[model samples]
Target: SGGPNYKVALGRRDGLSYATEEAVLSFLPSPTSNVTALIDVFTELDLTTKDLVTLSGAHTIGIAHCSSFENRLFPTQDSTLDPIFAENLYLTCPVINISSTTVIDIRTPNTFDNKYYVDLLHREGLFTSDQGLYEDFRTKPFVIIFALCQHLFFENFVYSMTKMGQLSVLTGSQGEIRRNCSALNSNLSWYAVDGDGHDGKVF
Candidate 1:
């Protein structure tokens, strides 16, 4: 898979039920998660450190809410952040209950590239998990590799994403395709098995 020329395997069925935010909170790494905490969460998804670093390149495009990185600026700016980067963030983010937006990638935020790795190296990463990749030796090498070679990052990204796409796969007749993308096709009770072998259901 490369660029928009790739096709994901089809006929995949949606989960019977969606996870509540509280239920999902435990599984997701916090914005301030350390390398260890991040590994624990990604490990549950069968993604390795290399995968974590490479996959994080997706942050290259998109905007983040201020709440996602405000802690790094307010109270006390994170020492890991470059002084100029932190100052810019403080100007962009307010400490109170307000919504704000900031680019995820400091370099070419409009493009999908391996610049995220470089951003991490420069202490320009938006989240702690991102900066952690550069700080931790285990994942740092991969970040460096990805930053130096976009081709390698692209290849690895395709493979990791392919693996991720297959993690919770179910075969024919296991579940029904949703008639609507936003809502379940039916309200009647339905069930499906997850990647971790847990049975999921819709109320």
Candidate 2:
């Protein structure tokens, strides 16, 4: 069987510097960000609404901090939630004053899976960003599509990722690839090598 064709592009440079804290706070999407907010962010980069829905599938991986969605657990939750789902999330993300340790994506917290959409149907989506995708009429259909078909979800996710990668990027000539992501320029930094080398670092 023939696999997808591949090509190499050279001269991709690393950015001299990453976004600052203020820059991140100003531009990074927040859990409380609504559909309009998401649209604005995507528009800034010329991404379409379809790309937005497809890229939003990134929620399939990673966990949301409890602080991001504690409101759903307290006061009242969306009536669409199954009782068992509500209780399960409540147990995993109890309302507490802890710094930032609780997680909301209970099922397959670290893996990329369609469970994120399943969580949405149950009103258990961890982030307002995640839940907002389902609430927005423009993206809801794609959300349902992703929920039902894992293969389709993966295909769209890859497309979205490809589009996202087209956004402004830093070239290696502009910056050095930090051996340690956590400690950007620490020469004494001890780096841990995983099975995939540098692939596991979040940023």
lDDT top scorer: 1
Every candidate's lDDT: 0.80, 0.68
Best by TM-score: 1
- Residue 197 of candidate 2: its Cα lDDT? 42
Which stretch of 10 consecutive residues in model 2 shows the poorest summed lDDT? 1-10
Residue pairs with colliding backbones in model 1 are none
- Across residues 105-179, which tens digit of lDDT does each residue of candidate 1 receive? 988888888888889889999998889889998898999899899889888988888888888776666766665
Give candidate 1's TM-score. Answer: 0.82
True-structure lDDT of candidate 1: 0.80
- Per-residue lDDT over 1-203 for candidate 2, one digit per residue giving the tens place of the 0 to 100 score: 11122343444444546678998787677877888989899889888887887777666666566677666667777555567876876776666443454444567667777777877876767677778888889888888888898788777667766677667776544554555544444342344335764424333
Error of 2 at 186 (Å): 11
TM-score, every prediction: 0.82, 0.71
lDDT, candidate 2, equals 0.68
